[model samples]
Target: MCGLSADKIQVATGHVEISTITNHYIKTSSTYQKQLLELGNMDSINSLEVNKLKEIIMLQNQEILRLKERLNLENEEQTKNANLNGSKNEFKGVVA
Candidate 1:
């Protein structure tokens, strides 16, 4: 007895009847226990995969931010250079 009542087990397991859980699941067969263990392992494996994907997405987002910053810096530099050239051209016209 795992301390839970049959009714509780039936509700948790979503079985239609308490007798079904008592007859089918409450008895300990090695194969059933093994399957349960496998299910638990699968849950852990899926969690690990999800964590890995989240890390990858974070890295990608950081890279995108870095590229955007670099692009903005380049654009600012080009604008500054264009303004400098225009001023020089105007000064040359006045002198000539």
Candidate 2:
């Protein structure tokens, strides 16, 4: 299945020898082999999808941080403006 040689299969399966897989685990039937190959392909595809999702999550997290910083700066500016307005009102009252 999947065009891998017996030794390669043995290595992938963590068997010390190819005899274990050939004698017991693998089915020689065409349908079963095809299913195994399909499974291998799906594993590869799922890995790629998982990596892509991780990248998307990282980007969204960065955007959230940026937005939070922007909001914090806006709040600080508003607070400073409010304090300035309060001081001006106090000065006007004192002069009058």
Candidate 3:
């Protein structure tokens, strides 16, 4: 296990508060011991998971952009149709 102090661990992990890292993140007893033992392995796994999550977020953002563009196009078409219908109604009124 790394012999880092609580403050050092907080700084390294970018934790805003030492208590948060110690109290909430690092549980007590067997789980804590297991985490300490697999710290190096967990670091790699956590990094992989973070990268995967970022990729998923990027894909979701792209999908959202596409959907937004499609919605805008639909709205524009509807507006044009509405305006054309209004013009036809006005023409009929004028002719009568």
The candidate scoring highest on lDDT is 1
- What's the TM-score of each model vs. the native? 0.57, 0.56, 0.56
The true-structure Cα RMSD of candidate 1 reads: 9.8
Off by over 4 Å in 1: 1-42
Listed per model in order, the count of residue pairs whose N, CA or C atoms clash below 3 Å is 0, 0, 0
Q: Give one digit per residue, the lDDT tens place, for model 2 in 1-96.
A: 567777778878888856677755565767888988877778777888989999999999999999999999999999999999999999999999
Candidate number that wins on lDDT, 1 or 2: 1
Return the clash pairs for model 2, or none: none
Candidate lDDT scores, in order, read 0.87, 0.85, 0.84
Give one digit per residue, the lDDT tens place, for model 3 in 48-69. 8889999999999999999999
Q: Candidate 1 lDDT (Cα, whole model)?
A: 0.87
lDDT of 2 at 21: 76
TM-score of 3: 0.56
Superposed Cα deviation of residue 71, candidate 3 (Å): 0.6
Clashes of 2: 0
lDDT against true structure, model 3: 0.84
